[model samples]
Target: MNDKMKLKQFFPMLAFASLALAGCGGSVSKTGIELSNLDQKAKPGDNFYQYACGGWIKAHPLTGEYSTYGNFEVLIENNNKQLRDLIEAMAKGQHEAGTLEQKIGDLYNIAMDSVKQNKEGYAPIQADLEAIAAIQDRKEIIAQMAKLGSKGLPGYFGFYIDADIKNSSMNLLQIGQGGLSLGEKEYYLDNDSATVHVRESFKAYMEKMFTLCGSTPEEAKRKMEAVMGIETRIAVPSYSAVQQRDPEANYHKMTYEELKKDYSGIDWDVFFSTMGIQGLKEVSVGQPEPIHEVEKILAETPVEDQKAFMEWKLINSSAPYLSDELRACSFDFYGRVMSGKQQDRPRWKKAVATVEGVLGEGLGEKYVEKYFPAAAKERMVKLVKNLQDALAERIKVQDWMSDETKKVALDKLASFYVKVGYPDKWRDYSGLEIKDDSYWANIVRSNEFDLAYVIDKKLNKPVDRDEWYMTPQTVNAYYNPTTNEICFPAGILQPPFFDMEADDAYNYGAIGVVIGHEMTHGFDDQGRQFDKNGNLTDWWAPGDAERFEARAKVMEDFFSNIEVLPGLKGNGALTLGENLADHGGLMVSYTAFQNAMKEKPLQTEDGFTPEQRFFLAYANLWAGNIRDEEIRVRTKSDPHSLGRWRVDGALPHIDAWYEAFGITEKDSMFVPKEKRVTIW
Candidate 1:
């Protein structure tokens, strides 16, 4: 038989024993299988929770959302496989682009295009060291910073660069502000390890820049060392402007006048001018302390690097807007660092990204119509909804949660908004300059454009609700309780995660579960702190809150007990919310499928029933493997569960599993009813 036939035959053989519904590896209740038809059996990787969660493990093989779905990813992948095969057959004797085959085939093509435009795939970028020689004046030295932000590092993106302050633990900083919603940094300190990595990386990267600009090799090395020394001192004073203004702690929220007093070096009028905001005297601020400190430090720097740095910084700060040199600089630095070769991505992907970056999200929407398409979004949306309904049922059954708390929980769940495959509003990149050639210069111009935008926001109103942090092409999804939103970009809609034409079981079990997982995040342990308004509030009664904590504690301790690696205590605290989401998401997705079947009877055209396909779909998601070193590091650092455990941790919570497989006290997944944990 051919590969297709072989794959078709293996479906039932692989799924038969696993259908007891004890967990992810089990079958019978997954797709078309009724709870009544389960055959009590043990399968591969038995006696281990890893196999029980076979579905999840297979789905989240990659770091991104499609593979790392809560449950539905595998189903999506299976669907995609079917579509891929069909498309391939259609293209075997036809042209590449015009034929429908280009749809699936273009995933790599687009990535190649983007990578080529920005990466140094074949060779290093042409950075003119002579530009450093252009600095005849002292101010010219600081002007070099214009080149730095555009070309070298990725520090100022949304993530934090923290410092561990003695006696000042990061408490009270929970919720969105805690990460994005927490109090300002002056409450913390610099010498903290949080700042250590960023400072060192910046210094190292800047030194490379200085070296690249040298006239002689010896001079290059010496200048590089000097630049490193200079950057280190600057970094000691550099703190995140945004972190200081987090609104949750009642931070900055100052007017134009107050902010003006706080950071004198940053021209309030000019910054406001950049962002197109007017009033500043009475508005709220996200951070005041860090902004104040940055101003003080900027004021104190020596005249040479300080002045040029400020000017260069001023220009580079304007994101989505850039000088020609800045844009060229960006392309060079990005193109060089991302790829070993001078170019990596294909031209079309690069064109798309560049167009999306400059033309705004509408262009992306149009691009996706031409490229990503709506069918992918529809598939993802369906799975997400199924999982959501399932979670609602799970919450209804939670014995520990009081009815009042459950009501509020249900309210939050009901209010959850889904944004699958790109945002309605694209970031305004029209202000950004996109010039020809000079990759390094283009990047610098872009930095100036972005920096200006951020500074402008200092005086502007709160974050735009329509604004999306992740690019449309990015393969990731996030649930922001502060915003009460879940965003799924187009990048993650392909392969190994989602497909429009896979077997129902796999598509729903895999990608459907993933959608459910992200949706579940709204009600996760930490996410619960934020009300439906996306503000931090404790609507749950004290008693319910305590009970919820108690349930979460069980989860935390459960993970803490599992040794992912030697001596590495699973940070149950960090992963508690994710684990909860994983558990709740899988349970709900399964139920949703059950509901779907009741309405439609799950008609199976092929040899496989929806039930058989579901388990296979789940397992297929976690089909890939990882390196030991990679696994070890992820265990220590990543908040999400390991690929294997994510499967195990979620599966045992399913009540249907115990019913289907007759799993008893002897089964590792069997938790006494009284000790069972459930939250939705």
Candidate 2:
């Protein structure tokens, strides 16, 4: 639900690249069955999504956050493995002290270069921290925080939400829920044995951060304990990064003046200066609950502990966003607190993501020009249209859903604005810079710049067509009904999805279905509540809507019955709409392929028929392996079904599965025609 997710994490440009590897589904040597006919069609290499995401599945076997298999996350971990290979090659390279040759070994030549000296390193900060006992005035605390904290205030202790209660009489404050952790809330609060172990590990990490901050072993331990408590207070808030950014859910506006009267200890003037030095003078605090609670807690805290809390806040905020020295020092604390790892992030992991995030689309544009090619993109457009056509046709034929519902559904489909490649307007980063000494400053400036962009846009006319989300280098996609748009970034444009050189069967089976998937989002259960204009409202007749919901209920129960992990309960209500979309996406994508083959006088090109390949391509998209813990996490949080269920669930409704595989009741995926679930 964070802005990043809702923005654009799709694979339009990348999906087209999938076109290049099109129709390459060659036959698989089936178990126990000998293939005497070499001329017979083959099952594609990317058969079951369960298998394709095998490595990722195995790694993220446990689930925690949003439901389904962490499809997007699985890709990220796989990408990290690729990045690790680059790191390995660089580490093992034998070369001269300085040369472009050695540099080519990895992303940066000095990535692991030892510093020539530790001039002005930890000793000064250590001395200053000892002086903290002398300072008690709130203004002095602010000054010390600015000098030491990376974020000034907001950046401290993972995150510091401004529950500024300056204007409200009721005194409710909005607390930001999440910051950096394993992304699971229980990582901090859960008292279960595993959670306890993680907490102890976190405490150990806190000591590591203290060491980085120039504290001695004793001081580091003491400092970390202090820091951990402050962070826990912040963490206990009722929102996550996801919830805070969800405009659909969290749009309650309030005033600063109201916030001040409610939240304690924070002088309204000083607090406003920290958040928006210029803007707050004019506008009141929006929501003030978190600050109100924070104030109450601070009032009850013993005088001896106040300094400790304030100093820790200074360290937390100042550590991450300042200079690399501070960043490194800060991570010493943050890394251990969140992950239990005490080591610094490998330079490549942090910098490459930043570099690629910034320059990905520009570089991707070139990469596509050279390797992915425009032909692939153009061909994908045709397939996208074909999938759209297929959906439109399905709407026309849906028996359970009345014609009234179909009309509205078709309009939503027809209105889908496909955003492929990068945004028309790239984010303006001219104000941001990479300074040699002030990494923290640069980060703060960048954040401020980005925050300004979002805030400024709120006052202006909504830029509906602009891209406010992911760069093309990311490997995911999403459907945003609020904007009535489906975005496909350039990041996912390569591999597995489509291959221009591959046959029509593979291409259609892959990216064509993907296009269908995004298309289905427009008409998903929740999406159906919104009109074509992207405003949420009931657009369908009550009778027709009820029928549609009844059909979707079957899908909901199906997913509800399937346990993604052993004991964790699946949230069928949360995931119902997405399940519906997946089922429909499969149907729409399959039908498109069926139409594509109609004129070809098609025969089985692989050992498996085209229809079989079609479904395989689908399962392949979701293929993965997972850790049991990861599965538990995903089931508790993720909205989509597990990879296995996604494949098995969708197959029964696909009539083509029966025709192509000669599937009968004996086959697990087969459902009698009477029992088949269908709705447009």
Candidate 3:
């Protein structure tokens, strides 16, 4: 659901839902479920995930370049090749200056030019570093931070313009807790061996980066300590992943005057003006406690220490785009130490990712033309409709939810804004200039261009429901509660997820579940707070709301008991929304599969019934090998469960799954019928 894509077992046929009819002719066409992908030695009743996906996991072992390699990474690898070709073609061709093609080609070529990057070393960021060093007062520090923030190097806190939770229509500037380099608060606070190792490696990494940025060893150590001290103080007040999920707790709308009166440590006017934002009225302060802590740190910390932290921020942010040594050093700590990746991605892959980040929609427009088919979009529309109908049917029969709540839930479902394949309006990147400058310089300009777009074009404006957060070429989907929308980009509509030759059972379990998963997000713990119009309002009857929470607690508790790794258990509260979505998706998509079967019943393929194949297809979507380091990292950071748990931990709650594979009470993974989660 984040940004990963999946591609497996390509087929020749271009047909859609009609492909299921191929099984009605007394024989199955290619079911898109490869027999080779199944582990014959494993038993479904004991370990469904291992049985269904063990072969795929064994076949695609984790490589040095990846911490977690899965079906998603396979698709990413394929998409990378496609993107490389497109950018390489543009680089070879002579296009007009200022054109998107020119910008795309120039940016990729600049990023890939290792010789030039190594020659430039840290020279590109030297002026910015010196400017940070020259800051004398708190006002100057705030201004410098804002200047760096505009180029995406946020310091103490970060802000974004998005639909206000309550307002839902007007975009509001929201600032939140930040400044932690290791991301989560647990990494800094945890006494576990793994967390301690990561923290120590990060400290060493900071010192090395400071030394590389022209500091002596002693000076670098001092600066590293200063930055770590400020960050640790910020972390003390920062919200945990679970706590941040509460919309009501996070939202704190305050006027500019109130902000100045309450958090008067820094000059807000200077901060906004430096970022080219003028006459700001009000903003939603997300996590006031952390911001309060940040204010205290800025006021109490010495000027020299503050300057060192700011300079370190600049150096740290610029390291990846700097010389080979800097990039490797950064990766050694982040990629190798934190995530256990043995090597960095290829230069072409890095360059392609950079171009995609800056000019995604511009490149996506061309990508859809070349790779995305009109038929795919048309088929996806039909699939979404079926899933919606299935979810509505389930909603009508929910005994726990009262009639009043059901009516409103149905209304919200009907109001969904579904975007498939691509956006009707492409983003205008004409103003974005890419020049024959240093790679880091071009990246800085790109960041500035993006910030300007958000501030100038979108800030305080009405929310554009049609506007997509992800580009068409991204192999991911998202459900934004403020928009009450679900988007499936063209990049995910390929083999495995949405195979042209797969039967309805396969498609229903794979992409059908994906569609349902997003739809269910609207009814998840967080999304349920927002009503049909996407405003953060309580539309539920008081009794029904209480019952819903009680039911959701069951799901939370169920996942909390699962041991993802040795001694480390899952954080159910942190992953509740996604877990609920996964459960609801199975219920909704399975019903839709049955509805499709009413018209055309699918025959057994590869010695498995339709129901068994459905579950297998669903499990195949999550097949992958992951490093233990990644397991711990994702457990802390990712909202979704790990891949193995997504199948094994989730399927035990599904009633039909037991019937599909004849799972008995004696089975180790079986959940008592009374204890199984009933909420959708």
Whichever of 1 and 2 has more lDDT, that candidate is: 2
Best by lDDT: 3
Cα lDDT computed for each candidate against the true fold = 0.46, 0.51, 0.84
Tell me each candidate's TM-score.
0.60, 0.70, 0.96
Q: Model 2 off-target regions past 4 Å?
A: 1-176, 179-182, 189-191, 215-249, 253-273, 277-350, 358-372, 399-402, 438-441, 456-461, 543-553, 565-574, 640-644, 649-655, 667-678
Clashing pairs in 3: 5-72
Under the 3 Å rule for N, CA and C atoms, how many clashes does model 3 have? 1
Separately for all candidates shown, the number of backbone clashes (residues 3 or more apart, or on different chains) is: 118, 106, 1
**Residue-wise C-alpha lDDT for candidate 3, range 1-680, written one tens digit per residue:** 00001000000001111001000001125787887778979989899988999888899988899998887777787788888888999988899999989999989998899999899899999999888888877667788888887777858887777787799888888878778788888988899999999999999999999888799999999999998888889888888878888888888999989998888986888888888888788888888998899888778899889888888778887888999999999999999999999999999989998888779889989898898889989999999999999999999999999998999899999999888989999999988889997888887888888778878866778888988877787766777888888888887788678887778988999989888888888998888989887788999997998999999999999888889899999999988888898888899999999999999998987899999989998999888899999989988977788888889988999999999999999899999999999986
- Top model number, TM-score: 3
Report the lDDT tens digits of candidate 1 across residue range 1-680. Answer: 01111111111010111111000122333332322222123342233334434343444454422212333334333433433343334334434442223322332233233344344421223333235335555433323433442332221111111111110111111001111101122212344443344335433443433333222555434544443333344333333332222224433234456656765655546433433334434433333443344455445644434432332223223211222233334434333331112433333333334333433353444445545767777777776776767777888898878898889988888887777777775455545544444334454455456555644542223434455645554445667665677777775665445555444555667666667767777766656767776766678866988888888888888887777655545666656667887676567777787787787666553344565455545544443344443444344334576666665555566665555445688766667766666665
Q: In model 1, what lDDT does residue 498 have? A: 58
The better candidate by TM-score, 1 or 3, is 3
Q: Per-residue alpha-carbon lDDT of model 2 for 284-339, expressed as tens digits?
A: 22123444445544555443354565555445554533346766655543344332
